[model samples]
Target: MVNSKFEFTNIKCYCPVDKFCHVEYCYLKSVNRSYKYFSARSNIHQNPITNFTVNLALLKRYNGYKPFLYNFTVDGCKFLGNSKAANPVSKYFFEFFAPYMNANHKCPYDHDLIIEKLPASSMDYRLSKLLPFPEGDYLFNITWLIIGIPHGNIQIYGSLS
Candidate 1:
């Protein structure tokens, strides 16, 4: 994919003065913790995906942690090709989310994003690998984390994991 045009130019998160903050730095302590355990587990010859799962969970928890800018964009795209500039909410989700969680890097409709409104307390879950271009060809299992967030935040998290 082409690089995302979306940019978050002036975020004021508390960073140590001497170093540049990389993406991993955004999740610093968790990233370090992930590294420590991952290194030990890898030494014991466990699959890398397990380590990844732990790290991803930590990253997910970052959602509950305070964000430097509650109002921000993360994905690299600014707008869907046919999206209206007048729609502020859509604009916010696409730009902030497309890269942060890496979903519908283009426009959701353009990418075939399948959306359904499930009941608040339902135990049923939906999983989709297609109707969304590149993601459409892949398979994913929906899980409790996907159901835990409010519907609005669910979309913010890209397709449910």
Candidate 2:
């Protein structure tokens, strides 16, 4: 797809240095993780069109620990194509998320990514595979982190087995 234009604001950053403060760095890293794990498990190993699951532990063991990023755009072609954007609170299931994820690099694995965490209280989760574009018509905020697993409806995605 050809490139387009955009504009956005309301950003906050947390990086090792100001040089690494770019949101795209963190956002793209997260996407590449999902692509490597989820896209590989679903498309290559299990049923790509329906429910397929993989242990998050396996992903960590295989792909290295995931670097959780603040909610940001991973797939921004829509904005790049038509100048529109998506919301963080919207429902997203990365079913057909391969094309967008594989756009940058190849994801090779036998299973799909299905995270399993202790279902914590006051926390509901849905896997995020897409984020808004990082170009014009964009808004960004970054934050630092400590080691804690993300909270979401992870159980509903796949079984613990």
Candidate 3:
């Protein structure tokens, strides 16, 4: 595979539990001609997160973003505990932001969850070689469910060429 280009076009974060949890900031930043950053911060105001699940959906731009390759839900706590044991497809996506995220340990997260300054290059290898995607627009729809209730939704938009 020749050097593929990956860029984050936009990011939108929505927290349903506004009083309990809210997104502080979410944006895509361009540092230079070839470097871009994806950053987000969410704050939990109530009890710490003990049990949670994440729903991941990959969509491609086919007549306005139709579901494509994969979609599944995994226990967030379990994945955090042993990422290797999680489904390979989900594990691959999780690994994309694992190094930049602060929620790496077990449950009962008391502090803010943040993914700060995650460069697009960090995911280039996975998108190019690990599980190659056709050159097109794509969206990663990720939802956070706390104890069965939807807490937040993060939609990440990007393109490969």
Model number with the top TM-score: 3
Question: Which of 1 and 3 is the better model by lDDT?
Answer: 3
The per-prediction CA RMSD against the true structure, in angstroms, equals 19.8, 18.6, 1.3
Give candidate 3 misplaced runs (Cα > 4 Å).
none
The residue pairs in collision within model 1 are 6-76, 73-96, 74-96, 75-99, 112-131, 129-136, 130-136
Between candidates 1 and 2, which one is better according to lDDT? 2
Give the Å shift of residue 113 in candidate 3. Answer: 0.7
Cand. 2 Cα-lDDT: 0.23
Ranking by TM-score: 3, 1, 2
Best by lDDT: 3
Clash count, one per candidate: 7, 18, 0
Q: What's the TM for model 2?
A: 0.17
Better candidate by TM-score, 1 or 3: 3
Stretches of model 2 off by over 4 angstroms after superposition = 1-85, 91-111, 122-161
Residue 33, model 3: lDDT of 88
> Model 3 lDDT vs. the true structure?
0.87
- Lowest lDDT sum, 10 consecutive residues, model 1, at 36-45
Cα error, residue 76 of model 1, in Å, equals 17
